[model samples]
Target chain A: MSSKYSNNLIKSADFIQSLERGLSVIQSFSTEHSTLTVSEAAAITNLSRPAIRRIFLTLESLGYLTSDNGRYALTAKVLSLGYAYLSSKNIWEIAHDPMDELVKQTGESTSISVLDHDEIVYVARIHTKRIMTMSLGVGSRLPAFATSMGQVLLAHLPSEELEEYFEQAILSSYTNHTITDKKQLIKQLEQIRKNGWSLAEQQFEEGLSSVAAPITNRNGEVIAAINISTHTGRNSRKEIKEKLIPLLLQTAQKISEDLARSPHPMNL
Target chain B: MSSKYSNNLIKSADFIQSLERGLSVIQSFSTEHSTLTVSEAAAITNLSRPAIRRIFLTLESLGYLTSDNGRYALTAKVLSLGYAYLSSKNIWEIAHDPMDELVKQTGESTSISVLDHDEIVYVARIHTKRIMTMSLGVGSRLPAFATSMGQVLLAHLPSEELEEYFEQAILSSYTNHTITDKKQLIKQLEQIRKNGWSLAEQQFEEGLSSVAAPITNRNGEVIAAINISTHTGRNSRKEIKEKLIPLLLQTAQKISEDLARSPHPMNL
Candidate 1:
């Protein structure tokens, strides 16, 4: 096939600026604004409506975005691009087998998530037959204070970094059981470090409870966390602590072993 | 956040040209060539080595790519950019539930895949207890003729477009079971239209079998295919025909029902 448009942007740095703008246009849509009219995109990106329309047209042409009734949103093509990233990165490849095994052993909804800025982004999820009440996905993100994965990852932070986290703002409560206070969250994180696991009961959202333990590398550095979420009505804290905790820790250990063995350098 | 540098490429189309060059530099690496030296990137993209080096430096600073031992490749940060694309889409939200039900009914692995040029790209996959030996992944692609999903999608093509597919080049055989003859392949696609599903046994790869059925909207246009892949050792062609065919058809029906019920138009 002809490689007409499939070469490097090496002539000038101008392409870098356009590339950044294109990415920014894509970043404009979120949970709050799933679909937006062209004018709305113009307002959101602060680009002229005409410019936004052209970018939308190009994106749509590229099969990354789609539009209807004057509104534009992303398409499954974007997911393939994400898949490209995930598939190329050996982290998911190595982490998934252990995750699947963990679900088999624990009979709980297990997910592996990494910190992305302020929120915990789920990279992989393994759902047991018993898990049906709550819905979670690979790209799903939740607040750091309200999810077990978030707490365990937070627990690994240095003391100075922890202080900077608290200085940002008040933690908004998702449920009455959520830790909204910064100091209270810090205390909980410290306790999580001591226990080597985190349990969030009715914290992120009511009726949902989860337990998470950090997955570390050979250096004993926490890179991600594995969590199992069950409905609050299904299991007690003591039962989960006894039954699920050992399995989660074992899974984390197996993952760490795999990570250390492969040492596959990530190429995104 | 401020929307800085959000203009369309038309304002400075020269910048768009440069962006294309930069992207070419990034896209030069693949599964086969995960890491490359500056001269290799220049050779692959047909750009000067110094120009490639500067773009590489900028991309490394941008956290998109990384370098070590004078070899450069992408990083995990690329997943974030691709995830940005997925977070902006709503189709997966519409498609996820039906997919779960499909997996529940069929013990085989099922996925929703779309056409990206000549290759069929898996957008989503629902895997059950059985370990999939094949490397077919979310962003993974395969020759359309060698895959059931690809055939179902190919059947939807117009006559001229179908001719374009035939005109392309020799059909590379992935397995002894793969269909290489154009005349026979065309007949099989016609059979898929009559039978309402496409089945392939070790066509794409050895020791794997799959059946794919099309998911259409109210307009009766095929948008995507629902497929179930199982190990050849686990089931024979006769067993698959009797047990899996009906279940596969049912899953396709469920996806179609959900597709019809969706309020948003199927722009993809």
Candidate 2:
């Protein structure tokens, strides 16, 4: 992590290290550490006390961070950054009702995710119930090689990009059912690309199963993936494929059509 | 706006102007301007093209922004910042089911918002249907003095803060029912605080009405407000007050309880 941070610093003469440090300071506040002292932030970001202090002060002045009794925490202004990303895409607006309908039909958690490097970042979601051991939400990420949505997205990437990804990705064994073998994963990706959907049963986590379909743009380029995730104990793999995949596919098509119709296609 | 921007730059010796400018550049990209040229960004931010170009290049290198045929656009990596904010709060996670229940029971749009300066920033939302002229999602901002959630939040502020707000607020007239007079607004706030909830009839937009209640922390200080917004044409103010207020208040109390039970209360 430190090496990558320094690499970014050296990548460009104009790369603002202070900006990076300031964002890191904001990111340091998490569910476990909502409030942090300068020392704590410094420790997390591996920056100097003065550096952290300056960043904290600047953020506080901007109303993105607030200090109370020497402990710094993020304010609602920080949410605006997320809002910018979400509102720009307008995916939530388009996917809202469709996700709700999917959740209602499946009686399971439904989400839409986009590929970010080697991970799938969930952008929109509607939960029927908490079915996963790891809590997931709008911003949660999972390994791209092991999950249904990730595979669906990865399957749609250009061949050269897919090859580049295969070369760089670390296919760690997340569960007993995880496809850690590169060749096997590549084969699955090919099948998913041809079939227009992907399914994973206990690949990333034990007992969690999901079926995902690609959402395309007007040009038919895969822009995002939508999925319905459920527990394996409640429904067998065949049951999910039979019961949920059709609804999931229909919803993805609807979102894709909406995206095509929207005036702001680049935002999606 | 330019004066305020410069004022922040001059506030502290340690204030990172480059950091602020970099973030502003990111925030400049919106649904309307998802992709921006260096000159376009410079025009919006009042910064030089060279400075904007450097920031854009730096952001692209960091994977938060990408250059496509000379136009820079945000990547999914940008969503991580918002994710950091949303994940830290855990409010959406806690409120998801309850908000869904509220939407189901009331058949209206339900949302939770927190006061930010003179605006209310939506943090979590569950929509039954589109009810307003404007489309709203998490991270959307509404005038605090004109919306039911905003009024509920404003009503609970400390007297000194409320006085300061009243003194500084512009009290723009969004609709005929919008509270434009500071004195009248204060009187209404007093009634809302006393009643433990607020109801606004077409205060923000025509044919829109809402009922809101404060969600307090374990310390009994109001941290957020949750509301149910409906079309006034479909339901009368008395009907909303008699039916939705009870459920809205109950949901807010439930969320408040869950927030108090959370390990990290500062984020809420």
Candidate 3:
């Protein structure tokens, strides 16, 4: 394993390096690199072909992966891993109806996502009439400095963690509208924190715009954020701010209330 | 490890037992058992508490899991493992529009699922105004003999695999209407294979009904099944047969056509 994953736990004797290698190998296969040779996995994971082969054999034996023509790819059994997370969270079941209603009311797609380091991971999504050029669905990740949901989540982070995020995150300019400067992004996050919602116009993608509202837990901590996304061609920034933010805020509150009432809220 | 998972591959020297243990440890936390202690995981996986602790530490280090006090639960980062599967399949992307259109046309929820052994795992779903009592969504599993999509998939399975399924699967009658007899199920499968469509009326659950059609690949072989579901209270068998199956078939065909044309149709 590379020093990239080097940390106290990984360095400790109790931490299973094989488990980390296995996960890294699994993650190496992405939308771009859907299928990979053992050599390819070796290159991506910085491990030898023999080591990658053993991991691949183990995963194939476990039904998480399959290989044909010397190219290995993940199987549907791997989905159970994601299910473990989604089902454990139990937020999707409670948030589904309100999100569906939001989609109906707005005639746009809406999703719920939570912050993870420098990115936000979409937990649940309700799609309506959308022809998304950049396909964002459940389990999709976007930079926290660009998307509306990411901004809402970042705005709610504690001071120490937010500082850590800035320290680690690159804040690359994804588009002309992307806030590349840390101070500017932090200031915008402060404004979003005050407003309790955010609107990102062509920040992540040129024609894409979105507005997000924080979904709080019972203790009023922003556990996640919900967003309504529209094409810039279909919606004006002023219109999304004036019309959708209120409804998005209402839906977010409804989901938050449902989550609070839920007897089993998976503490992230 | 249980002899339950005993196979030739597991016995091989090349298989990584730790990787299998880690996956089993992860799978141990499901919707029912959302949170677990080291002792609980040890009991569930038949591993020692020390071993479970090590695995937990490893998973936490990898960000696939988290813990509070002594209780451990999966983290959203685990979603990426499942994303590897979904994104690799590339079917969900092509199936989305057609499945969404099917939901709109039928005024009900629609889903696509693939057969895994005796169960069907949902890969894609589009919900409209669904009040699902059983809570079937992406990555959810249902017994193949009890669900419409399952029957459609079971009907198309190769003879050797079908025989193995019958040998391995516990033919539990989930509901009063569930087909339990192997001979009767085989006969029904034969008919479903001939008919090219299926209507499962309250077999899996009372007051729930669904109709399904197969989605074929480039070879015209059934790769998956798509179904439209509604509450039995809302629709009678005759009405569903007359109204929904044609649309379901059409939707399945459209998705199949799209899958065939798409550069990447994941070979199951």
Candidate 4:
């Protein structure tokens, strides 16, 4: 909904169609289809087979893809593209120590993420638990409507922006606990804004609960959010409220204070 | 050097110039240049200002780039691109527990990486110490010849392939302790092949020491390597050999066993 200007840009003579198609092909590969044939890629991306083949060959030549017989799998060089954004931000340098300390204090998995469109993308993570059913990492994404960090991020959005988000976001239920009703979700976000923190009990995944606090910039605008995630059986809601929430808020505040000291984002 | 066939592929009509240029622009933004103006990007990429402006506009339209006046920075959508490769491999699900255990056992930083074109790209990691100068993460890359993981991975390469590696690799010195001499480097590889592990003391970085072991596939081919990295001053050379080496080797072996149990990589 926010990218309506992209329609005009897509029509511009300067817009690169081949680049979009090439990235589309790369995105086509997933857990279910780690490798794909030219035909499979064409069918998935709605490109011609010849066009898909050429893109695959170009990617393979560039060391971003590997060909095994006729099927093409992505190479590790793809990591460089995503890492560019993270490295530019110096996220690991800033977030690792604080998140690691939070994990040590809470003995739960901790993560930091920024709001990306309708989802939240994890930029940094410190996992203390090995047995979480959710096997998430740095690039993992979760629906903004169904996770504590997402709620915190969404809560910080300007009212009109939040309205646009609610209008466009697909409120699909991941679990029975997920808030799919728009009105109900709005109430939760209002409460989160007032409380300065949020909790999601098995909303994203069954038997998992997490509490999150907003991370802000120098001007006190929310830039990102961090969470302490735990299994519901291990940490009851009462203990989470009494024990983990305070530590989570303190870590979030500490990280925000550090971000305030950074020079580049000061202009914001 | 290995991409001679790519020259012919580049000549093909199927090769997409726009795709390559777009990716190059994305790669140009780094720690030093977190954001770039059109002029700066054109200079770095050697594209015309008009062409660069169009590409930047296209990237911004695609939600891959964010613009403030004339300066542009990458957005988190780029994370999804690099994450595609990591998610396809399910790296965290397999490596996290073992790496966490290794960090606990050794009280040091531990990481797993795969060899990508003579460089080791970190695939998984666990951190216990707070003050290591190396602020590393999943997508970090380091020269293979100068680091323990790189050495272990290189040691497992076929003889001709190893020769080709030596033929093309840039053996520039990172520190005074680096083994830039080819004869000496080959001798060390031979010993590492026999010893089934590697230790690099202040080669890649000053005051850092690491010991690594190969993680093999089900068929006994080395696929990746894991390392226990610590301060050379904190753990003496002799103490590293006597204490950390055995624990590091055991952790690597445990990971190799778990990897062997997987069914997909069995075909390798």
Instruction: Rank the candidate models, highest TM-score first.
Output: 3, 4, 2, 1
Task: Estimate, for each residue in A1-268, the C-alpha lDDT of model 2 and write its tens digit.
Answer: 1111122343457777777777778778877787889999889999999888888878877878766688877876776776667666777668887877887787888888888778898777776743221124666788999999999989998887787778778999989999999888889999999999999998999989899999988888887899998988888767777888888999999999998997764645
lDDT (Cα, tens digit) per residue for candidate 1, span A138-212:
556677778999999889976665565566535887889989877788889989999999999999889999999
Candidate 3 residue lDDT tens string, B1-268 = 1111234264477888898899889888877888899998999899999999999988887777666687878877888888777676676678878876777777888888887667898877766653321124777888989999999998988787787788898889878899999999999999999999988988989889899999999889887899998998787877788889888888888888888897763544
**Pairwise lDDT winner, candidates 2 and 4:** 4
**Which residue pairs in model 4 clash with each other?**
none
DockQ of 2: 0.38
Residue-level lDDT tens digits of model 3 in A1-268: 1111223255488888888899889889877777888999998889999889999988877777666678887777887778777677777678878887888788888887887778888877766653221124778788988999999988988787788788898888889999999888889999999999999999999999999999988888888889998999787767787889889989989988888898775644
Regions of candidate 3 where Cα sits further than 4 Å from its true position: A1-11, A130-135, A233-242, A265-268, B1-11, B130-136, B233-236
| Model 2 lDDT per residue over B1-268, tens place | 1111122443468888888888898899887787788999999899999889888867766767766568877776776776677767777678877887888788887878888888998877665643211124666798999999999988988787787677677899988889899889989999999999999999899988888999988888888899988888777767787888888888988988988887774746
Go through the candidates in order and give each one's C-alpha lDDT: 0.70, 0.79, 0.80, 0.80
Residue B6 lDDT, candidate 3, scale 0-100: 32
The best-first sequence of candidates by DockQ reads 4, 3, 2, 1
* TM-score of candidate 3 relative to the true fold: 0.90
* TM-score for all models, in order of appearance: 0.83, 0.88, 0.90, 0.89
Question: What i-RMS does every model get?
Answer: 7.8, 5.8, 5.2, 4.2
**Worst 10-residue lDDT window, candidate 2 chain A:** A1-10
Worst 10 residues of 3 chain A by lDDT: A1-10
Q: How close is candidate 4 to the true structure, as a TM-score?
A: 0.89
Candidate 1: the clashing residue pairs are A7-B24, A8-B21, A8-B24, A8-B25, A9-B21, A9-B22, A15-B18, A15-B19
**TM-score for candidate 1, residues paired by index:** 0.83
